[model samples]
Target: MLDALAARAAGPGRITVFEPSPHLWRGRPYGPDLESVLVNAPPAIMSIRHGDLGHYAAWLGGRAAEHLDPLLGEPLVPRALYGEYLEHTAETALAALREAGWEVRVVRSRVTGATGAGTRMVLGTEDGQRHEADHVVLCVGGGTPPDLYGLDGAPGFAGDPYPLRRTLDRIPSGSDVGVIGSGLTAVDVVVSLAARGHTGRISLLSRSGMLPHVWQRPVERQPRFVTTDRVAALHRERGTVALDDLVGLLRDEIDSAGEDFAAFTAELLAAETDDPVRRLRAQLDAVDDHRIGRRFLQLTAHTVGPYAWRLLPAADRARLRRRLRTATGVASPMVPVNASILMRLFDSGQLDAVAGVRAIEAVNGRFHISGDQGRRTTAVLVNAVNPAPQSIPRGAAQLVDALAADGTAALHPDGGLASTDPRLHVIGDLAAGGSFITSSIPAVAFQSARAAAAVTAASDSGRALSG
Candidate 1:
């Protein structure tokens, strides 16, 4: 967002950012962490600058080789390394803004309340300071992972597994560790533990023991049938795009590339019921898949996903929600390096994942887990289940509530905040009425561009009226 504003704003204006964290540009996910924790997406899709496919890669010029993952055929850098990119990008943006006659200030405080003050908005911070702004954009990021088992203060329980450097050392090297989700965060915990030379047995407990699919070597193919323009055209013609309409577009995309749609859909469905080890093995073997279905879906997810989501009828949305687990697994695959680590652990009988987790209890200084696979105990338990999309962070909850209570903003029926005032905007994952998978960097960049344009246009309008 700062990048967008720097490039487009016709400003000799002031911009103040209230950030309480010492790691300014590097949020929780990209903060200092074990080298094993990697940026999940490819460089092409991870750019902070909107519409610039090679932005991140251009910055990684000479050091790309050091972070390259051979299996995925991409430089999956450490989270800390990526944080450096963010910091550099932010500094560059700030420099550009200063050159453009804009004064930018960063405040080390958290916002606690927001209320409308005549034509402006007044923001109150935790440190008992209030600042007024003509426009406000909430970039609070996502919420912390919830503790599902009521083990917040348990001796051996880790409520959040982030910055694993802080949590991993406390656990005995040979003690059993249990992770509570089968998503990317869980993958991080497992891979980081192995990287630290921890020989403990590890188990991933979930309602559906479905791990993310393995990412294939990316191909240089753009979608012809599944583009955003085509989706908009469909909505114009039919008023709404149904689930079957999307499937038809996908089929056309795959068939045009000379792949069998039936075979592809069947394989995707089979993955949900297939054994986790065998499924992962199959995915690993097929990393060089010649089929275009997966690639098409990956490209369409962020590019066309938001538009299609808005046009989808309630029934179609509900149907997609029913299969969200499978859809998310396919859309957000893990990089091959982590998949290989998991494979090695599975081969050594030191790691396993089980579904239908019924209950978890803290007992006798250990964690006991009961599920479909029956009872098991572990020396340490880590919560890896991410919060739902657009969940308000605990720190920002009071501010969001205040805005809603006073009608400055309204809570979306779906998640996130909806602005009632033109001066206020929402971006990133907190923007309401976005796709379920709207938290990606590409999506955030898209939203940032829109918000920046809106803010600048409004500023220009105000100036012209005064003149």
Candidate 2:
């Protein structure tokens, strides 16, 4: 994203990147110690421009030293190393900008608040400092993790799986960890805990039995396709997808394409590997709602040609032929794995599934939770609970509420994702209303560019970026 910004503000302009976090370029999601959060898609899936291959990765992680590209296939790089690359790129960008007579300052301070001025911005810093800028880009990045929502006096849980590794070290070793959700975050916590050598037991509980698929390499390549229908397949746009139905639809699409959807997607990434995000977004822009009907079929069936015969449903294939394909609702029982770490825990009779976690209460020193199933015990209750976009925020919800009431921003309906015109931008998982299978490097870079452009325009117009 910084690269995109620098490229856009190539001419005479001043851009100040006000990042409060310790790690500026990498943001909070990519902390210093995160080395194994391998990107899922192929390198082709990443990009800034429509054809800029590996621009972000080349700048961030450098060319993959290995033959396999994690962004393209199942390769995983030390996420921390990626962070280093980002820092390096930011420095390089700063130097070039200075040499070219562009004014840029990367400040390390938390912006307490900002009021949008028509031609400028009034920004308050953490140390009670105040400043004005010609423009402001509110790249707040991801929000606090879903698990940290309601807990009080949470001195130490197992560890925060979010950005910032120092927070984890704050917790004492050998502490039993109670993970609230069973999905990816839960898995992430388990993996990180093991990495840190936390010997205490880790218990994971979630309403649904859903778990992410095991990583597998694609076997064969498929073809590009465009399905002209999709509304009926639009199920729970703001939440976890129906694993079985989603897999089934992709299975069918690949079958038609004469290969597995994964392989086909691999090929697509490889072909567009240079700048897949931009090209894909451009393609989506071209289609928009004009081809909503087609999008429905393409969403699920589209992947069928990508994933080989490894996983799918026979019933979905028959239904796609007889039914409108768009009529089938997109939700299905989640499939589990035999070798996954979470599955291994489940198999060990350590973790169990709860129908739903209704409320969390502080009973004595430990937190108590009640749900549809019943109550349970735990050493430390880490709220792995996913954020419910529709749910009302409690009394303490402050920043966003203040921002919305003051008319500085709006919310995207599907997930209440923060909406900003141009000067202000959101990135990472917190940004709403984008592709389901999205990446940060490219998609995030795209947003940063938009934000930076707005800032540059304001500075040129003798105005504020937030205006």
Candidate 3:
């Protein structure tokens, strides 16, 4: 959506998209059962366009008594309200596009397969139909789900959590339910179930029993930061920077406006991939913090700046990769889950958080979670674990096989699930770009923008480009 929007806004090629869950635009990872899932990221930071940061707030202002909206005091508003806010912003964007001469095509079909030959790409839809795109962008950023295999009576185990929102609609008023994760989704399930007045005993199961950390609102400033200096010192001294110290220093830098907090953070993230020594230190530290290790996985993303995650020197990257062995690591980017939701579940006593299910054998009527916490069962078992190429419909696997067979693309290992052709970009839970974190708007926005650019650049037949 961001790609098509940017393309149209840039007066580039006609923008067309194939979104599987077409109506899912209102807010994703959405549910008919969820009534209390609030946007954890403050609405202020959640806008698609940086220029429209407080646009939703202004609308709420108009609706406020004396226009003093309570939401202002607390930026995290209910998902439903945010849904409306998203609709309004999207409508405004769509209207603007229509007013322009660009023809935007949005097809509501799952892209089961895609391949490129020369300048044209062939894409297969869920309905067995194929379409052509000058360039194709796979919005596959939303990570796939788990495959429930060796667990007891597991073949009968149903592996759907997100789509099962409707299953929850008819759930008993107060039933005991077992959640399989302590991450954000688990949290979301608890909160949503709570909103429905279902006071059930919910247990969250995970291997490490780690819950996500909460996102505290921005606090008043403290001191200055030195990025290159810190990076230089870390490289020179080969040591760790305390989290608090780093945060304080970075905050000071952002306050000085010598750098964009966003850009600086982006750089730090980029550096994690570029500077080998730094990336190794990060991975080593992260391995030790298994409780909330994923947070560290992200803090060191591939950086465009000197501070982010990037490839270490061959030696250091190799060392880092070795240290990362025990960690539940990703070769490519994966969706970041919600942590606040998990904490909410724990608070409600709805989550019985446990880890490791040896097998999922069945009992008299339902399934048993036979493993770490002994045998207990639930009426249903939904696989909420993050999906990889191994999990989803064979469509992706088959598509990837075809890509390799045709010699049109090469897999980038850490799942580069389907990025064989730059002209054919992939996003959402599928890209496997070493950074799959969430199916959130922010994640998608970043992915879509990149996809749009690649597609646009690939489609350039006679256009002058501007940077």
What lDDT does each candidate get?
A: 0.86, 0.48, 0.49
| Residue lDDT tens for model 3, 1-467 | 55245443544445555656555556344423344555555455465553345656675564424322132234455566666766676666656655654456667776656566755667677789877666555444344455554443443343555544564664675766766654555556666666666776766655545444333223333222344455556556655434344455545555564444564455334432343223333333333232322232222222211132232243443444443312222312211123333334555556566655666655665667767667777765555565542122343565665555666555655546545555555555555434323334444555656555554554334222111
Q: Which portions of model 3 miss their true places by more than 4 Å?
A: 1-4, 7-12, 22-28, 31-33, 50-73, 84-91, 126-128, 149-158, 163-165, 220-307, 313-351, 379-382, 388-404, 418-420, 436-443, 454-467
TM-score of each: 0.97, 0.64, 0.67
Clashes of each: 0, 41, 64
Worst 10 residues of 1 by lDDT: 458-467
Kindly provide the TM-score of model 3 when superposed on the true structure, using C-alpha atoms.
Answer: 0.67
Give residue 55's lDDT in candidate 3 (0 to 100). Answer: 53
Q: Identify the candidate with maximal lDDT.
A: 1
Q: What ranges in model 2 sit over 4 Å off?
A: 34-51, 56-73, 126-130, 147-149, 154-159, 163-176, 196-200, 218-223, 227-255, 258-339, 350-355, 359-369, 386-408, 411-440, 452-467
For residue 316, give model 1's deviation from the true position in Å: 0.8
For model 1, how does the per-residue alpha-carbon lDDT over 1-467 read when each residue is reduced to its tens digit? 88888789775777888889879988889999888999998899889999898999999998889988898788999989999999999999989978977778898998888887587788888899988888888888887898888999999898988889998988899999999999999999999999999987999999999999999998878788888888888989988888798899999999999899999999899877999999999989989987889877877887788778888998888888788788888888999999999999999999998899999999999888898889989889989998877678887899999999979999998888889987788877777877677478888898889988888887553221000
Sorted by TM-score, highest first, which candidate order results?
1, 3, 2
For model 1, the superposed segments whose C-alpha errors exceed 4 Å read 461-467
Ranking by lDDT: 1, 3, 2
The superposed Cα distance between candidate 1 and the true structure at residue 416, in angstroms, equals 1.5
Error of 3 at 76 (Å): 2.2
Give per-residue lDDT, candidate 2, residue 292: 26
